[model samples]
Target: ADGARGLLAMRQAGARTIAQDEETCVVFGMPREAIELGAAEKVLPIEAIGIEALRMAGEPKEGIGSRGAA
Candidate 1:
């Protein structure tokens, strides 16, 4: 709850966020809290977090786009 409160504060101040998915989390509790509080804009696997952040920041790496494209 405390973490969610802090994330909410940052969010209200125009901060963007990414969160770890339950399957990828050792203690899904905290991340789950922030997610339920609407603090995260994207929730993804731990492996994908960095890639997603880079993409969000407009600095994507080569050969990583649409990882599972049809």
Candidate 2:
């Protein structure tokens, strides 16, 4: 709950925030809370989370078509 609130605050401060999707969670409490609080801009599966984060950070992903990719 506290972590969700912190993510909310970060979003309110204009940060790009993401939460893990419910289907992929072993414990959905935190991510569900964050989603309910409108903290996450994107809710993604666990496998894709790292790649999405890399994309958001402007890092190349070889053939993954992310930002800065050539």
Question: For this target, which candidate reaches the highest TM-score against the unseen true structure?
Answer: 2
Candidate 1 local lDDT, 1-70, one digit each (tens): 9988898888766666888999989999999999999998789999999998888778543444437656
On lDDT, the leading prediction is 2
lDDT of 2 by residue, 1-70 (tens): 9999999999887677889999999999999999999999899999999998888778533445435646
Predicted structure 1: lDDT: 0.83
State each model's C-alpha RMSD to the native: 9.2, 6.9
Clashing residue pairs in candidate 1 are none
- Which ranges of candidate 2 are over 4 A from the true structure? 59-70
C-alpha local distance difference test of each model: 0.83, 0.87
**Candidate 1: regions farther than 4 A off:** 59-70
User: lDDT for model 2, on a 0 to 1 scale?
Assistant: 0.87
What is the lDDT for 40 in model 2?
Answer: 96
Give the clash count for model 2: 0
